[model samples]
Target chain A: MKILSKLRASIAVAAVLILSAVMFVDINDAQAEYGDVVINNYSDGAGMRPVVFPHWFHRVRFRCKVCHADLGFKFQAGGNEINMVKIIDGQFCGACHNGDIAWSVENCNLCHSGKPGTPTQVHESTVQKLAQPSGAKK
Target chain B: MPVSTFRAEFLDTVSGLARGAASPGLALFLWLLCVGAAWAGEWLPLANDGIHDPRSRAVKILQQPREALQGLTPDHAGNQVRWVQVLEKGEIRPREKLFPQTVVQKLDLDVILDAKGGMPAVRFPHRPHTEWLDCVNCHDGLFAKSVGQSKISMFKILQGEQCGVCHGAVAFPLTECARCHSIPRPGQSKPVIPAGIDPRIHQAIGQGQK
Candidate 1:
């Protein structure tokens, strides 16, 4: 009778532990699976201070075939060898910047000039000047 | 008083005490019954078959993209899958390479080609058909490579191109758009963009008729 009582008590404890473990795994799996791939890279690749690639800004105008096919850019970065000198030449950024699609070297300030947070300043000044009346009468 | 009457009364009292002791046994039995009930409550125990375990079942069911998409429906037991462009090779005018009832599936290249283009997810159903065929039926010589440059186009589709090489004639009719792009419920959204106005809306509009 004592042995039977012990067996029953052990089974009850085992059942409770099993249920709790299963629920814990279910929650953990959900969080891990849905976690962001891009977010992981931010921490892992933080040392590089990676180049800012604003996706929504550029993608609105260009087709995938233009940069991917014509310019020969691989899907993932570091997949292709990119050199700044090559971009200055008629290779990557220079493809359209030969004074056709967008501004040329004359407008170098558009990209390489502004420091972080300074781009907004330039836009703000332009808006301020536009709102002001010209000193010289029309 | 007689000694026999005293003994009879004593025996009746002992029987009453025995009944009282059995109540604890009954309570323990009830507690065990509750535990057994709790064990059965989890669906995993009921779902596990002898051949394939529940985890294995989730894996097996998830492997087929169609099964994952269609979900575990009663209609899934039937031989026919609702949506898919079925292609069979060499059954039509361009009877050059491949065989009849060859499956030609179209994978979405939007995400692969451009990061910003977003994932134009494909709706592939290989289970119901794979039951009848093999891998070579679709892949053939042009097995795996970067998409889009493989030369499959609208023209090719009309002339039985990549997938058209089969679906246009043998497996199922090409006129059936709903076969692949099934009529979604109202407000069904594309996978690539959010519920709000798509940023690519401007690009897609710009490319119109140009």
Candidate 2:
């Protein structure tokens, strides 16, 4: 009975060490996942959903200076006070995204998908998947 | 019961309960708490003292640049300094280059600004500045990337905007006007005065020549 008690105590200690080790290893892996910035400045109050700006999709095509410097976009998220009126009048994101350059502003659901907790379908890009840090699972 | 006997009995009861009643999952959780407590004890003191704060750490690191440069030369030991010699010798290494190899394309673009009051046009070289600083430092916020987008004026710069951000504090002072205004004199191949020296000293020498 004493030997069995010793075995149980040893097993408990070993399990604790293994669990802590697993937790420590997974912490960094979880943070390495692709991050997206959600721009919801006036969206919710104006009866619209927030725009999810995927950094990976934009970074792959253009340099940081192209949008930030040339287009006069602020560095911080929600730094630029963007509105639908300014966008329609060809300011901010509307400068290039006026149908001819990229996409038209008429497509409402394309940008304003849904609220924070609502079930929304997200399109996964192969470029972003490939760019993930090594040892990160799909 | 004696104190020693009572202590022993208490330990025995606790150990017996741990082995008999407590599950492996509970044991694991308790162990994690103990480990976390120990880690907190080790790190919390240093963090609370502001040593772990990123802003303070960055300030500490940046303060070392002058001292780091001073360590290399004995002649200029504790003297009023200039970094151009260290840069020309290729002794100063940017902190970014010490990291893992990341291919960053360096463009040597020259911007010639026409002087307002008939002073020599300021020839701005991108290569030298880009060697030390990242592009984001000046690109979007300070100066627009698009040509002719920003209205850069000497008065604005004097008021601690644009180039004044670094020049007066870290780089050579704005008093050294000939450094940027590199227009050659009528009879000289060079600018008739060397760059990187105090313009006040140059003016005194010019007065002596006359």
Q: Scored by CA lDDT, what does every candidate get?
A: 0.34, 0.49
TM-score on alpha carbons, each prediction:
0.23, 0.34
Model 1: residues with Cα > 4 Å off, grouped in runs: A1-51, A106-109, A112-138, B1-210
Clashing pairs in model 1? B87-B166, B87-B167, B88-B102, B88-B166, B156-B161, B160-B164, B160-B165
True contacts kept of each: 0.00, 0.01
DockQ score for candidate 2 = 0.04
Per-residue accuracy of model 2 over B52-93 as CA lDDT, tens digit each: 222222223222222332333211111113344444455543
Candidate 2's TM-score: 0.34
Give candidate 2's whole-model lDDT.
0.49
> Which predicted model would earn the best DockQ?
2
Model 1 lDDT at residue B86 = 18
